[model samples]
Target: MKNKSVGIREVAQHAGVSTASISRALNSPESVSPALRLKVDAAIAALGYIPDAAARALSSRRTRTIGAIIPTVDNAMFARGIEALQRYLSLQGYLLLLATSGYDPEVEFRQAQNMVSRGVDGLILRGDTHTEGLRRLLATQRMPFVNVGVYHPDKPYASIGADNEDAAWRATRYLIGLGHTRIAMVAAMSAHNDRASARVAGVRRALKEQGLPLPDDWYYEVHYRLDDARQAARALMARPERPTAVVCGNDVLAYGVLLEVERHGLQVPGDISVMGFDDLEWSRHLRPSLTTMHLPTDEVWTRAGEHLVKQLSGQPCVMHHEVDATLVVRESTAPPRADA
Candidate 1:
């Protein structure tokens, strides 16, 4: 196909200037005089010489695109965070390319590599689960990225997250204050999840402070599924020495617990109290108005966006960005009955 079209040379001729001057006027306007820069710009528009974006990026070394890799879009928590990030990026003359890794650490690393190769100006990640090998690769490539959900205490990377330990401790203490002596936990696998594990630690800390030790079988390690939560809740409740209250890893798990308790003809805060983390939107709307630790989703997202944009603009990111989670007391939690 013989396509006859205008090029930079034609535009330069139309502007009555050398190609080098036109290139400077288009690529680096600050280096060119105003009178000539305007002339080259008019010529460019008149000739319909659409500049290749990739070529422009290569010459100017900027794509104006940022990448955000999250665990999964299925959860409302991550969805809200990603939305805030995208909105903030758009206002700053940057675009966001989102990817989901389905909570797989290896997949997160691969997605990060792919985003880097695609020439993103910066990247945002959900947690610190990215393998050390991937970290090395990013460092070697000089790619700029920030951790959004969790923090690494010893490192200098930018991060924005709530105090998982404190949130968990508060939730547990609330349960204890309500006279829940035997408390059980239904948690997602925390081996590779620093956030989940920290939450669990907070629960233990509260228990230890209260001179209580969790039963061996009280800790249910399973995937974060409602069905699994239901089955696990049933098993826990069926035990001879069941907990008077249950603290779920998240709202989804708490919902499952409520469902299982209802099926067993048990009333929440009557027979048992149930608490959950991450005050999901539906938490307040639920029948019992769930009691949960309200993770500052909006704050977390806004701060992460601010940090990433600042870094991309060659500004120093805030050293310690920690937000507190608010505890919402609702109808779902109460003191355990003496009878169990």
Candidate 2:
């Protein structure tokens, strides 16, 4: 005769623990003591028990699913964070549901509503510039959610990310230290992004500190696409008084800027110096290795996932988790040439 499916009760009995303990061990491992969890795991292995997801959902009202809505999944910067989030969530027996807004707040709100309707237990969002409708929906539902990519303690929502303003300030200051007064920035559009807005603020502040004026055309914002970056760089260079140094919003933008500058017969660090943000893998391998800011993408998203899980387990979570982004000096940046 075929053996009946092993159940939680059977596993608990074999493990000499209560059904409640078994449940905690399975869903909220952090809540259970190490010794107790080990015993439950051993019993589960010995009994060959497979948890009944449906029953757990019914009793706990948990979907064991997390949803994330980022600006754009097509970009590798956001893709790396999403990958890290998925790995951490899966380790906790939770599935990740992903959606992208193409940088549109309305689309992000619709996606958030759809995920909520689908009964996600938690959410991980890129930034907090979501539509008011989505904000109201989340507040009304009282669902656990964490914002990733920018950190602000004064905000109502919980967040786990790098301090965008400080990081950008440091990056800009590095360029100033290189003795480049004619500086320009190619940045991501700040229309609905707190991170981009904060970074722009940082750049402006850094320039002000050095008594350098940031003229209207000196700072350009565009989408997170290589082609847009190329155009922005070309336009900046076409100006009557071109900048000797350029700061890009991200590595991809930096890639585009570098290519455009080279296409114009300008030798990097000889006529112009460029700086990039986000020390991505390719940044290190570029012909003239990039001098950039190293944002901890994996660490931030992994921590965001753990924070969401803790909140879902009815545990108190830290509201603001900030990671550091440090400057990486490489070959692409140097003091402007004497003649230039």
Candidate 3:
């Protein structure tokens, strides 16, 4: 009732080429001339032949597949980066496998173990911090991996990303220059997130340098959910002396803060100024445009993908690459009011 699957020999016969030529064309197209590749491709299409990936991997000892684990795909920033990474990998004749850690180190380690067991050629991880077991497993296997989203050249592993601390410090400095002394922060939970922790540290450093008080109640760490950010902002605003400005760790938190401000009938940059990191697409289109930090998401992820590909291909790549995050000022921040 059904015909058998086409094999390489049939493809070679159809293309009037030897089986070895067909092999070279499929395995390493660059090794053969363009005309030979075209002939093999046409023959393969004519016969509907599908190469056996299992046999090929067994012979080559490489799967030609890469694995990536991110904290969460719910955020637009991570989504955009993952999309870019996948596109780059596909163009390089490799496949991308993805997993989410949900900001949990234990979960991340488990996912890493699973990916390794599946025989991925390399791994791309988010942040430099990882479970000891995960690191040990990778080291035991001598697996090639790179950390994205935060740059730390001093670390043992390869890293490609923005300098979180400096970016946040610059952001805080901008708010300070606007005459906003009473500033608060709605930051992501920093427990397992080195990026968020670094951003918080940067904000603290800037406030300290300027002799501005960073009161205990002024800093709030919540989940990256909009509702959580809204709740944190509501709590901050309920206090007798509300802050004149609020700095958020990322754009999602900033969006939540903006919504809460509107709900409370407060005007942005008038009663309260707000800003964020990761200048997301909708940030610029908001009623009062959001002033935020812009990360080169596509470039960062593409470079991370390139680094892993190079390591797998036996090419030398720099251990660290730092992409700067610049501030994007808009309608949301201004000098604080003289009265009150």
Candidate 4:
């Protein structure tokens, strides 16, 4: 049997505390003494009391829940960041509600509206590009939200993340420095995804700076699936003049390129160099190991969570915080051979 009828007053009576203390313990444990909190906890446990979240929200005008909208939950990089954000919010006595948009602006807007209707205290969004409706909704509601995975200081909204363009530029420069003029790219679909678009732009900027050609034939954009990436690699290899190096959008894409290279009877760095972004855990353990740009995913997401917490708590927070991504060179990339 369940005690669905247990109330705050019953909990206060059991703990030998006033109703005000019970409320404080439930809502703001930090404001109350440890001894008092312990008593309240014990009492609640003994009575099996479950506070009504709706009632609490109505009274406090806060749900203590933060909503996060991400592109996809399948990617390991996003998984790591989401885990970090969830952990940080839990420590701050807040809950994390996550939604995936499949990289669609309309879908993201709908999800944001749903979360806001459900009474989330704040929101954490991915990238700077969002539907105007979503932006207007947040602004109209005065909702506190921060964009993660991209840092744009000039943007009116708050943001905390790495500069995707800069990271990709550095990666392209590394391949160029390795004596590879014939470079190609296997990137994610850039439509409706600012992060992916910025990566493509970065590669172009770096190549243009060196007066290198980035013909339409040299770049292939596909979904983030292994099969898609493998197909793109095949198409790139089938070109009349195959590039000596391929810059992947992320480690997963790089892995697919590596596989396709093996299937084509090629050797990494020996025949074709590969560079990746997002130093995922498996990137380091790949057969030849991946040379990648290491984004501090956990740190960026944790900071985003912290920023939302601060904003909800009426504390000052930086509008834009930039976390740098470092290049990690390993077995997957090297100078191209000179043999004809």
Candidate 5:
């Protein structure tokens, strides 16, 4: 037979306290006497008492739940972060509701509204490209939300993100250090993405620092797909005076670049060098492991969860968090041979 769940009343009885005291001890430990709180906790453990989330929410007029909206669940990078967030929130008597917008702004807004209507105490959004209506709604509702994975200077909201600009700059500078002057960038479309734009800007900054201009023909922006990236790589490398090194916007793109490089009868780091951003799990296992920028995913998610928890509890949070990225040198990046 299935074991019946124990209720707060049973815990209260076991602790020799009123149900109200049990509730206060569980919800707001600071408001209860230490001795009584200990008794309540002991009883709860003994009985395996679990609070009814819905009932508690109704009584408190606040849902101890957070909603997170992201581009997609297909990406391992996001998968790691979101999983960590949910696990941490679960440990603190909170729940996480997740939504995927598939990188569509309109869909993102609708999902955000759905989460708000569902009575999430706080929200976690992916970026700052939200529609004006969505932004206004959040403003009018006075929703405590944090933007993750990107940041904005003029925006009056908290954000946690990696330093994409500096990371891309380092990637570009690494190629430059390899004696590759003719460099090319295969990047994602930055139309609605500040992170993508920042990456492109970082590459530009690196070139400018070397008194060089990013030639128009050397840059290509495509959708975030390996096939598209491969086609773009093929086209870029087919030029009569092809770039000696290609820096991709992400590790996925870099993987495509490496595949197409071999298809074009070129050798990596010898015929052409390749570098990527976001050192994914498989990046290190490549034939010539990808030399890429490593995002501080674990730390960023930890800080973001902490910020969201504070916001839900009406506590002040460090509004802006700028985590750094590191360069992981691998076999894919090397000096240009004199013959080339």
Candidate 6:
């Protein structure tokens, strides 16, 4: 005959504890004494018991899994963060279910609801634009949720991210200090992306502080695609008087801008300076390295995972964890040409 599966009752009996204690140790380890928890763990090991996830969910009313909904993962920035989140969640003995929202609020709501319907224990939403319906659903279900990438502490979910405005401000100020007053910006659409919105504000704030004028044509808005970025850059450069310095929203946009600049036989930094955000992998390898902000994506996602795990385990968790990005100066930025 095949060996029987080691059930919770069997482990409890072997450990000289009630089934309740075993279940408590499994569901909420913080509620159990360390000594008793150790005993339970040893018993589980000796018996080679594997908790049936389905049965455990039935008993504890928890899926022991988290769902994360982000914008597109076409960029490495999002990919790196999601990878870190999955690794951390796995280490904590929980699973991560991910979905992409395509930066659409309605799609976000649908994916969020779908994840919950699949019985996720907690949820992670990106940006600051959680739908009222989604918020109500999470509130009504009493599920723990956190918003990553944008920090809005006064709101319901705990947030983990950098002050995007500050990061952008630093990037812009660096360019201004290089004596490049006519700086152009190549940015993603700011419709619903809080990061994009804050970055735009930061650029504007820095320029206004220095009494620099930002002409209407100096700002180009495009999607995350390089094609769009390339088109935007080409168009911006075609203006009556082109900007000497261009600040791109992210490395992808910066890469496209650089390509456009090179296509026209223009030099980088030597003729026009360029700066990018996100400090992506390829930023350093370019012929003229990129000057950009290094976002702590891995750290941010890891901390968010830990926060959700703690909340799910009945352990105390920090309500909000703020992170900051560092400005990296590289070959892509410099003082404008003397003739300009």
Tens digit of lDDT per residue, candidate 4, span 1-340?
A: 4677889989999999999999987776557888988898899999999988888888888898999999998899899999999999886778999999999999999999999999999999999789899989999999999999998999888889889999999999999999999999999999998889999999999999999988898899989899999999999889888899999999899999999999999999899999999999998999899999999999999999988878776778889999989999999999999971
- Look at candidate 5 and tell me the lDDT of residue 11: 84
Between candidates 1 and 3, the one scoring higher on lDDT is 3
Candidate 6 per-residue C-alpha lDDT over 151-186 given as tens digits, one digit per residue, 9 for 90 to 100: 667765699988889889999999999899899999
Q: What is the lDDT of residue 86 in candidate 2?
A: 92
Better of 3 and 4 by TM-score: 4
Q: Model 1, range 149-238, lDDT digits (tens) per residue?
A: 765556777777877888899999999998889999998778777788888999999999999998878989667788989999999988
Q: Candidate 5 at 285: error in angstroms?
A: 1.7
TM-score of 2: 0.89
**Cα TM-score per model:** 0.84, 0.89, 0.93, 0.94, 0.90, 0.89
Question: Can you list the residue pairs that collide in candidate 6?
Answer: none
TM-score between model 5 and native? 0.90
Name model 6 segments beyond 4 Å from true.
1-50
The parts of candidate 2 lying over 4 Å away from their true place are 1-22, 32-50
Q: What is the C-alpha lDDT of each candidate?
A: 0.83, 0.88, 0.91, 0.92, 0.85, 0.88
Q: Better model by TM-score, 4 or 5?
A: 4
Which residue pairs of candidate 2 clash? none
Candidate 4 TM-score versus the reference: 0.94
Task: Give the per-residue lDDT digits (tens) of candidate 3, residues 69-107.
Answer: 999989899999999999998866678999999999999
lDDT of 3 at 148: 94
Cα misplacement distance, residue 308 of candidate 5 (Å) = 1.7
Runs in model 5 lying further than 4 Å from the true structure: 1-5, 15-21, 24-50
